[model samples]
Target: MAQLTVDIIRARVEEDWTRIVEVLNRKIALQSISAKGITAEHMKRSAEFVAEQLREVGVDANVVQSHNPDGTPGAWEVTGSKIVDPGAPTVLLYAHHDVQPVPDESAWRTDPFVGTEIDGRLYGRGAADDGGGIAIHCGALKALGDELGVNIKVFIEGEEEMGSPSFIPFIESHRDEFAADVIIVADSGNWSADIPSLTTSLRGNTDIDVTIKALEHPVHSGQFGGPILDANTLAAILIASMYDANGDLAVPGIVAEDPIGGLQRDLDEATVREDSGALASYRFAGTGSLAARMWTKPSVTVIGFDAHPVEGSFNVISPQTTFRLSLRTSPNQRPEEAQEALAAFLVEHAPFGAEVSVKRGENGMGWAMDPNAEATKDALAAMQEAFGVTPINKGEGGSIPFIPELQRIFPAAQVLVTGPEDPKANAHSPNESISLPGLKNNVITEALLLAKLAQ
Candidate 1:
């Protein structure tokens, strides 16, 4: 492999800027929303589009399909490779080709399917969330060309927006084909447009459904309301037990904090409140810095509830009620264990001897990467050089289940999560975008990291 400096990589990425935008725009034009109404052929087209770009950059790419749990056809997956040397370390790049459903087209300033550039940022449905990711991989490969020192593998799935139901089966069926020594997941966002970041940790998630039954059937509220509270009231008690007066998760056996030092930086309360769209008078929950509460601590939210609506006069006492609990565990805790603990808590805390039943939903494990590893140092240096600023390690409050699954399947591989999306990217919402300069910098950073691994 020929030695390449960061300066040369930056210059090459700059030269390919126009082509990168063109590719991103073309990708944006394809509405690959993997939802209920979308068809298999529609998804296959997006996968083939990505494969075509990879092939153009000298990668042996193909659009493949994985199976669902019932042995039915699942979402399309694009897998490809560029092996420079059998002896060199292989790096796997991951990003999704599908996007979230646009709930309201009228909210968009520009057409969601047409990539628009305004004040140096490209706006579109998939621009930053993941289309930017595809551009990064192809741009880096194109810029480095024959100078790319390490082996490269690309896995761009078409079902990430739908929770990647086929991810486990897909990976298990082709474990060897996706093997690598290093993995870069370009699905997360940086701190800001100018500040680069690497996501070192992610909170795992588990969902549980609980039903509380107080009566066999509905009875007149006037007769049963006083002696026995309605099932909905009993359900409220169970939900309130999840938190203490401090608003911390009241469950036991679930890890609460990082156990190491928490976030390196704390978020401003006002800024977080404004960004989250919380009412000014709404007091924040949980104890500790906003960053720790959001990134490292455990949280339980009642995502769904079943009860009588307030639209009509309800003169009868409800017999049963059900609610769904979405639990976000600490970065280092196992979601299965947390789920068990939560189930036990709900059963034990059933108020007024209400008959409670807990049903386990799905779970995804969390992840925490070693920040001092050799590849991590290289990545940090690459980001520093590309962005001309010090890089920070960040922890995402949300779960990217597939990432930890990849780490579990390939225990020897180093997983690094970084991307061009910023806080203003508005991913999954109206006016989604990516900074053009940030996109170029990410390409240069990835190219430099690929080169640094060679040495």
Candidate 2:
């Protein structure tokens, strides 16, 4: 803590690239997709693999089991621990091994299960969010050996992508096991490939499934064309009502909080275009700063639909239409209230008195960290020292539902969100990747932060 040499930390990461890649490669090879696999057995095996690796570095590592609220098997948590001093605060290293399903199989430049490197970027489904994180945790422990400034715990989660259904329950059951003064979540992305960022806020998420029905059975389009109303059309109209001409969510009572003063930075158009795959001819939706629109506001997208197949001959008015909606809410917005307003809008505005049912799916509240907290400042200073650049306060558009729960469990603990993925990492999408530089630099940042926090 008293003295930190940049070159030494840099060399530590560089020298361990072989083992790092090995850990990540093994994790990538495992299809621990919690959403698709209800039992999550793959998660348990993956956690054991990580624990074995952590044990190689003298950490007391083991796999802990916890169940989801519905009694299903939740993600397995791999915990590795060491204590340099009993008095110093413990630092919890957090990340997940579960990954999102590939959007399109043909879109992958390389096998999604095989970790491959091209032009200095590792390409794979969970390479960045957060197989890379697993590597970083192992690498950092290997570097630190038994000389850590404070006690350290590495927590590798298995059900993060499934919105962490049982995270609250697990945290509550193992309150003493998770005791720590600071938490560093490595499931976030940086501002860019070259820039560093500290995620200060995360937007909450809610899923709403709606089904509209007009008649019990379909009627011939030609026979009842003028008089009969199709459920698909009514559903479409109600969906369109969610947005105004300006493209912002027009649903009544949807909350949008202002960006933290002096913390917001409007993303540049060129970067947004490249990162978002937006074409020049396409117009941007929503109002206000791009950062605010993405990070702190409510955004909706139609994620699933049940309708007639385009290739199938359907010359009949459909009797029912079902759709799944995903809503990202502001940090402080009440999830149930927003869901109630949205359900009311769809049912109240149903076309021709069509029956509409909006079923609320899983929901998670967002979190805002105190930027000026001592642990945050210590980690910020460590990041700047590691990269030779000042890291900016950033808000992640994605949701880590357990963050708010973790805060509730440890109200006095400081949470600092950091990760290795960049904008081009494309997490939760095809060709998800992490650059060599970013991977090494972020690991060094975490290692340095742990040391400084011990001080």
Candidate 3:
């Protein structure tokens, strides 16, 4: 393998961004909401489009489908051509085509289904989250093949937003076909808009719905106030007990370790509040650096609560109340163990005579990359060469369930999480957007990294 020149890679990326944006916009226009998932028609169209583009660039590409157990739309894979060298290390580039649902149209400034460009940012649902990253990877490969004569396989899944339940089965069935020396997950964002980042850890997640039942129906609150058990109040008490005053999770057996350090930065509270749509006075619990508190500690958030309405002022004791609890465990914790601890806490802490039931939802283990891996070194070098800045290693607070599965299947493979997205990309939220500059940088970096991996 020949040494890749940064200037050549940058030039190729500059030449390809225009076409890449067009293709990405086309893909984003289709509503591939994972909650509704990708329709057969939509998947077929997307696959066809990708296949055509690969052929146009004189690369071998094809859409491989894996059927669901019941014979539904199980999973889909798009494989590209190999680099010239027969022994070149195969690199699997992973992205997801599916996105979360757009609940309210009025919440968006532009059509969520339509990709809109405003103030140098492309606005759409999945623009930055995964679409931009996907485009960068595909575009970089295309440009490298045409301009630098390199090749890499591309594997984009359609169920990532849905916890990627189908990914493991797909990988297991097609293990040989998906073999890679390293995997580049371009679904994360940088530490900040300007600073490049490689995510080294991801917290695991578990969902539990706790329901408390006391009375059969709503009774007059004034009359029943004295002794009658209020399900809502009981539920609140149970929920509140899950956290200590310091904002640290009170769940048993879940240890909160100090973050690896160095990822800490003084985040402006005002900026955080504005970005998170919280009041200026809004504050997070726990003591530590923001990054440490966010990515290292266990967090318990009551995502959903079911109770009586405030408008009705229902002077009654509610029969039943339920709250959906989402637990983000530490990087090394097992989600199932966390779930068990949570269930036990809720069950043992329930109010007297109140029936409390805990139902476990989806659970996934966290992922922590080996910092000493060779592939990581190559990736860092590639990023430095492309962006002229060393990449920052950090941890994402959210869970990408499939990462653990991938790690289990390919224990020796190095996994690096770097992408085109940024902090302000508004991923999983309204008016999500991606910076054009970031997209271009990702293309260049990925292209250079592909060359490095091949070497």
Candidate 4:
């Protein structure tokens, strides 16, 4: 790598910092919630906005459309300036434009759809998790359009928060256009406010709905007392069997060992509990290293329950009960295998005379990247030059279903993950925000990366 002037890059970032923030806030003001999955209108508006920005920078930009599995129109891709050499290694910059829905408006400090800034933080629904990241990439491209002399493509998805169901099909249909030597996913966050990090792995996820049935109809408790089999009681027993006294998962086939080389050093237990808003004396399940249990082990959560409330309770035995189960599996673990393990456990341990039924939903695989790849090295170097610090290799517990698909299609490409969020970004929660300093630094880093990749 040739020696680059750091001062020049910093100056470019500062020159356009305010404009970048304005663009991000403006887009946030437009509600493009894709929680129920991406609609045709959402794709259209996002594509137009991105293309307009690229055009303003004197770069040729266009959108490529694809269809969903239901034969309905799906997402659109925004591709920027092309490379002179067709065989030269190309880089793809990826971010999702869609955001999760804000169901409870009254819970937020400001309008969830309206972007607001206070105390150096930009507050909005998608400000940190994704929208802010997209802005950083666009700002970087605009600032270094001429200096970054390589082929670059920007593929923004419209259905990431909804599990990216249409993204795999889109990639399959446009393999040639999406092909690249390196893919940078600006969707993850740093370990802390000052600690830079690169996410190298993500956990897989699966969901199941369990139902227990006892009788055909509800019977009065006065007449059937001590004789009727209560569905609610059976459901309680089954759920209780999922964990042991130590709070560790008691199910078979789920690995619970410490991770290789241990976990992150700054992952304090207090901070974890505080961030998750746990009770004052609450404790996490399992034992051993925190990172290992979270990133490399399996975790089960009871997401929802269907039952009669005490306020509306009648003196009768309920006929049915249902609950939802969510599982997070480690990298290299098979979703099918985990699903089967959980199902078998419930089947064998179900209470006597009670029929237990389990239904599975869409399952996605986990991902782990090669940290020593050339593109990753270049990205790290570029980030170091831009931020004046080295980035730590890390793993994320959340899953992105489209990542595994992208790797499958472009088997040889390196995937680099980093973004503008820190530990306090509060993505997916009330009052979500992004730090202005973090956004500006990310813009500088991405611009430097473009120039480095072109070299």
TM-score each candidate. 0.96, 0.87, 0.89, 0.89
- Which candidate number has the best lDDT? 1
TM-score of 2: 0.87
Q: In candidate 3, what residue range of length 10 has the lowest lDDT sum?
A: 146-155
The best candidate by TM-score is 1
In candidate 3, position 255 carries an lDDT of: 64
Summed backbone clashes in each candidate are 0, 0, 1, 0
lDDT tens digits, residue span 261-335, model 4: 335463678888887788987767777677877777778888998988889788898888899999888776788
Global local distance difference test of model 3: 0.77
Candidate 1 lDDT over 354-428, as tens digits, reads: 899999999889888777778898998999989999986678899988888999999999989988799889999
Question: Residue 198 in candidate 4 has what lDDT?
Answer: 74
Error of 2 at 305 (Å): 4.0
lDDT of 3 at 263: 55
lDDT agreement with native, every candidate? 0.89, 0.82, 0.77, 0.77
Error of 3 at 107 (Å): 4.9
Candidate 3 local Cα displacement, residue 451, angstroms = 2.2
Give candidate 3's error at residue 348 in angstroms. Answer: 2.5
Tell me the deviation in Å of residue 407 in model 4.
1.1
TM-score of 3: 0.89
